[model samples]
Target: MATSVNRSCLTYLLHLAQDNLDFRLPEIKALLALRGKSFHPSGDFQEKTPFWCLDGLAEEDVRGVMARSVCAKSAFELWGHGQTHSELRTSLLNYPSENMSPFMHKDSTYRINVYTFNKTLEFPDRIKRIDAMDYLPFEGTVSLKSPQHIFCLLEDYGTDPNDIPEHPNYIYFGRWIADGQRELIRSHSVKNRHFIGNTSMDAGLSFIMANHAKVNENDLVFDPFVGTGSLLVACSHFRAYVCGTDIDYNTIHGRGRSSRKNQKWRGPDENIRANLRQYGTEEMYIDVMISDASKPVWREAPLFDAIITDPPYGIRESTRRTGSHKDVTKHADGIYLESHVPVSQAYHLSDIFTDLLNFSAHHLVVGGRLVYWLPVYRPEYSEETVPLHPCLRILSNCEQTLSSHTSRRLITMEKIRKPEELDGLAQFADGRFSPYQGHNAFREKYFSGLNKRCIKEDNKAVVNGQ
Candidate 1:
């Protein structure tokens, strides 16, 4: 079912003891298959398989099989994945204890790639089983006494009988990462498809969360103002149907490029003419229309599992549009969003952030999540917190300022079943004495306090009878 090159891809799932050994199996299997590794030897393609984690390298390399494994050790591991598994093996055979102690060893023979399909795999602990072999000592000053790496071999006698060169008794987890996986990831890469300079977000953060969001095969994902179609591409990586919309012409063109059977691209980026040549999207055209944000709507569709986007925050792209006949130029006041690349037409989208949020929520499935990024800065304090949605339970003494760009808050929220969940919409007037107010003392009192006018009283998330 796969080309020989891909079939030979050595897929391995390294897990530590007590970790959720089988937790990521299904997703991993799907990801690999989506990536194009549908022909693994593991059969039935079960996850939670255990593999040996060596203790010779750094802990960061060891944690890479886990989510938070992006530490210094993992940096080396990712490097290792592409080349030199044998060199690392040789080092382990010799200096088993350099960081942990001193790695010293002697010549040894035989190298094995193992997979643990049944139980938990922990390094050093399970490695004790090797005691019976009296394996050669680790060479030189780096001895086994202090080992920095950790690992878990799947089983004792599991081996893949193949003509692969170098070592025997070598095992493989599945196959190399699938081609489909790369394409899927690439399709959503913020860097690859960055059509709008400052108006787009990458697939990195969403990809990370999708790994933890507990999604299923048929769930749907939505991205309003879907700049360059990054979120939709990432969602498809998880096998979820994607629905994206945007207001730009190029964005619409790029999104519409692929009209193939493998995909069902819907909304603004729906140019089936170009897409069919490259992918497997549907013949049923994805409906993308140019509607005003203040008044937006989509042909009736199913509710969505998540709402993911990064909207303009007035600062990066000033919400103010300036025109002098010949050409128009706009600017954001340095909104300090770390990954944000400011766009030119920002001035045209000011304070409309609320409208965007309201429209996005209108489509989210109850209990579904809404993830977005915003920029917020407090003049009194230095440094800004990013991805701020996780910490909000209530609002108080909040000042809304047009972004001069110090902090762009990333707001991610879920569409709860009831309005009481987030108090609907709450407003804040800048107090004259407030930090945002600067020195205007007379305006402080009236500008401050609970904003009761914007609160929605209906069971619905908001109200706009029209």
Candidate 2:
């Protein structure tokens, strides 16, 4: 049995509120057990209210899940007395698990997440020397889980200005336990701090990674063409050595969106590199290197234990050109894809598959899985437009069953039974990049498991009470 000391919380980072808490939480408990741990639900929640409470759970039961012996940080003082607050300019975030079974549920678009911290929100504070108890209405459920430098600000009191905390604690929630106001926004409160932007990749896949707190520690994981370094960032946070690469310097992994094609300074030229610094990695610091994955150098036995990547668009289009940052600032949330290059200016989808399969054949180790995407447009458009690679097998289509935007068909492949038979799969190599989805690798981990275990495990399954 995996001892409690060996168990770390599995945090699920995905689109908040898309599925009910019931399906997501219980599955997390099961995933822990899969990692060889004795599991139990300490507490779980939505954006608002207590999903699980320590009051009902015995102290022993609470201790079962809150294994401090294996915690990353010794102690975190969140929700000490009143409300804690913080803000972020990125995609996802993390916090210890909490209880949330109250408040009425809302629509699919209104996403939220709930959390609990170590001995936090346990007892109300009574410090009066700073007139602490009644000062500034400071409180519990503070946003201490944030990776951002500023969280839980203490209101500027003593007019001296310098007397206050650098970014002091602001809001306060007493023993009353008021639910968080921004629960509906799935930033730091629920989603894992993987990618830089919100809702770019599949949230179901992102949720699984963000929610995952621990893994086979020290495992060597790879995310080829890591869009914005989302999968790799989450993997690093989940206790692994991460590697990611891309074709050019205009992506999340690449240099800032704006550089000089004509030697003119445009925007924050150091943004992407600076963003990576915050996560504690430098170029080549990780096991990754920039190169074309189409005809990659494959080792018979890969030094890497796992592989995850979001490849370039078979038809990629974006605004990540040499001077796109200035334009992005003028655009909304840096989302306008105004200028760019064609991913595959040469051929359509068929050539892409042949090359992609050949790349996987040589690079992906035996028993190592390759999870990728296959978009099937609405049923009516039937012209065999999307190319198919013979080696890659269709695994599942959970997204189609749940979402309305576009359904993704999950695909997977292992080494051919006989190595000599690697003839047909072409040598696809698309050089273009887009800022949209790099969920290729992680979604495989999420759905490939479902494809193997439960057939009905998806967003709709939660609503249908599976």
Which predicted model would earn the best lDDT? 1
**Candidate 1: lDDT over CA atoms?**
0.38
lDDT of model 2 at residue 188? 26
Q: Which window of ten consecutive residues has the lowest lDDT sum in model 1?
A: 70-79
Work out the TM-score per prediction. 0.40, 0.41
Off by over 4 Å in 1: 1-200, 209-216, 253-285, 296-302, 314-350, 378-410, 420-466
C-alpha displacement of 317 in model 2, angstroms?
3.1
Taking all chains together, the TM-score of candidate 1 against the true structure is 0.40
Q: 1-466 in candidate 2: lDDT tens per residue?
A: 3333222232211111223332334323423433455434223433322222222222232332333111111111222222233232111123212321111122111111222221122122312212332322223323335412221212212223345443323232211212211221243222343224321354344324333322234766666556555555545544566676554545543344333344333244333334345556534236445444443555654455445554543333321212222323344564556463424222223333445555555554554445444544333222233333343333222233333323454344444332345344232332221111232232344345446455545656887987
Worst 10 residues of 2 by lDDT: 68-77
Judge candidate 2 at residue 134 and give its lDDT: 30
Query: What are the root-mean-square deviations of the candidates from the true structure over C-alphas?
Result: 19.4, 18.8
Instruction: Report residue 298 deviation for candidate 1 (angstroms).
Output: 5.0
